[model samples]
Target: MIVQFKDVKDLTSSPAKSEKIHVYKSGENKGKTRKLNAKPARTGILPVSEKTVWTWVREGKFPKPFKMNGRTVWRLSDVETWIAEQESKATILKEGA
Candidate 1:
């Protein structure tokens, strides 16, 4: 006869954070951590062409997408921040830049 026991600490421990989870956890979500499955972002909510997205990324005007399993993807938070930045920059340019 044999007895097996599981480590009790393992049951109480927090799950390890993935990159997406970490980003959401680091005060990025108004201090709320979102699910890791939260959709990655597209430049336009209306299906933007790849060239536009890549152009901003290349120009350092957009958050660089991450390589995931051979596919490039950007986090929702990053894309949102980039959009806000672009809007602000556009306003500043119109004013004087």
Candidate 2:
């Protein structure tokens, strides 16, 4: 049985566990399988929240995401560059100390 947000009596109210709610996870999500890099030059996985993504992009610290049809995505190269940069900086600080 599928329920909608509107069906809830109150937004602040909690529902009984027996209500038969169904959450889902796609089969691919259950494993350590990596995402298909369909567009290697224009797609990636970034460890960031939406808020921080936008901020970093605006500040030029992050790569500007590329558009696929209409959806924006980051390039794996850009993400790797950022990660390597961070690691380099960390090493420098450690060596300085």
Candidate 3:
């Protein structure tokens, strides 16, 4: 099944589950079977609330997100660099203190 998120509500919600997903041990699809409880991957982006992220963006505290095919998204490398810079800043503050 394919899912397309038109808005935040769609993105945050999960689809209905299906029973008995087929599995394979060898090359062919003839072995064991299990349920595949698929979950959306949330990586690279900050763990804070969406509101907080928007606030940070407005405050110029976080890297600006760009539009990709009309969908707003941030670059993984940019977020990683921001996180590293924040960690280094924290370390320097700790040392100074």
Candidate 4:
């Protein structure tokens, strides 16, 4: 499922640390439910390196990170949505070809 950024931002704007975010899993665990984290776990899921992630963020291909207690964190939902979008585009291209 693709999580909207506005929804994520609204949820994070509050002081509720216990609030859990829903993220869609891919691969063997596809369609499974998972708890979201603000930690940088993009590389584990995405095929790109840490530097590429930062580059994508700078180029507007990726979502901008949120600041949490002096630590830069990305909403897991946003990352998942971005990944889904990329995969969808790839599928479209392959189909067209």
Overall lDDT per candidate, in order of appearance: 0.52, 0.52, 0.63, 0.64
lDDT of 2 by residue, 1-97 (tens): 5422211111113222322323345664553444332321222244344566678879998767766666565555566677789889999999999
Top candidate on lDDT is 4
How many clashes in each candidate? 0, 0, 0, 0
lDDT per residue (tens digit) for residues 1-97 in model 3: 4422222222223334555586777766568786876655443234554676777889999878777788886666676688899999999999999
Off by over 4 Å in 3: 1-45
Error of model 2, residue 71, in angstroms: 0.7
Best-fitting candidate, measured by TM-score?
4
Q: Give the per-residue Cα lDDT of candidate 3 at 93.
A: 100
Q: List TM-scores for all candidates, in order.
A: 0.44, 0.49, 0.54, 0.55
How many clashing pairs does model 3 include?
A: 0
Better of 2 and 3 by lDDT: 3
Model 4: how far residue 72 lies from native, Å: 0.4
Q: For residues 1-97, what per-residue lDDT tens digits would candidate 1 score against the true structure? A: 4432222121122324444653344544666654565443323342444565567669986667666676556666555566688789899999994
* Model 4 residue 1 CA deviation in Å: 14
Model 3 clash pairs are none
lDDT of 4 at 56: 84
- Following a full C-alpha superposition, what root-mean-square deviation does model 4 have from the true structure? 15.4
RMSD of each: 20.5, 18.8, 13.2, 15.4
| Model 2 alpha-carbon drift over 4 Å, by segment | 1-47
Candidate that beats the other on lDDT, 3 or 4, i.e. the better one: 4
